[model samples]
Target: MPTRKIRRTQLLALAVAALTVPATAALAAPVPADAAAAPTAPLAAPATTASTTTAPATAVAASPTGFLNLPTSLLPTDRAPHEISFQYRNDSAGDQSIAPQVLIESPVGGPFLVPTAVSLQVETSDGSWLPLPLGIETGTLYTNLIPAKLVLHSHHTLTEHYRLTVLSPSLGTVAPRIAFYG
Candidate 1:
């Protein structure tokens, strides 16, 4: 009976010690500062002012004068009736109009003809250029994708020279070339 009582006391003491050990350790540890503080409000951003000076031009210069001067006989003679497309970005401020021209030259003994349809568009900074018919919105950056489709008869060949002429009132003229197999 005495031994049983001693065992019970020992078990109770061990359980109590185990329970208290974690509590004591937790009490002794330091609490992090952030844990005690209340949730903070987001900081306000500073206001911005417009600049008077104009931004530098970012359009890449075209090679070989006005034409996107490509190698001689770039398109295969066998590949007749081809289409050429170009993609570019214009981030100039203020309002501007751009006229793009797609030119295709005939290969040796090949037919030379003007493109059928040419597309020039300016996208707003928000990536919505088409749905809005107002043209490029003011103060926002834009991407202009201009595609010129040319139909050349079997006798007419593709020209190695192709150029995209960007006539902007604000940025002047920017001509970028195109080089494609077909």
Candidate 2:
């Protein structure tokens, strides 16, 4: 009985998430060439020296610069969470590192989303999915920052998986975005 209830809840959540996707929705902007060269703060680095800056973390992260907004899409109306895959391609000659972010559209002023699990996997020549080594860094769709652990090789594409739920009562749409920074 407990297992059945869990499955029902997962199905309900996925159904709710999929309702937000438009029937003819199109993907967002493509990644630019210079996007791979964009510089970002180290994913795992501690402060060497203390106490010069007193600004808040949000203030410091205000509108990241030199970043490219990768393609974005909401949950498709016809597919379940597991059946859906977000793809990103690396057209450059060298490998490029990428990070994932999400944007939530809500009727309320502020909304919350819980990301249960996220994973990045690359596609093999034989059309198999292989998991990539993920980093310890964590981020949410609202934070617009997924750690840069997975790298896409030259002319290769990678797929990402996201399991998310909107904690708030108000319905909100979740769209995933990718950012390139190598």
Q: lDDT tens string, model 1, 1-182?
A: 01110011132223333333333322222122243122121111112234587656542222111112222223323223322334322222221122223222332243322222222232323333222011121221112212122222222222221222222212111223322111
- Cα RMSDs, all models: 34.8, 15.6
For model 1, where is the 10-residue window of minimal lDDT? 1-10
Per-residue lDDT of model 2, residues 1-182, tens digit only: 01110011232233334334443111212223355345353322211223476887433222222343444445332323232346565555555555554444343444333333333333333445543222121122242232222445566665555443322334444455555443
lDDT of candidate model 2 versus the reference:
0.38
Which one is best on TM-score? 2
Give the TM-score (vs. native) of candidate 1.
0.21
Q: How many collisions per candidate?
A: 4, 0
Which clashing pairs does model 1 show?
68-177, 105-159, 111-156, 111-157
For lDDT, the strongest prediction is 2
Model 1 / residue 35 / CA error / Å: 71
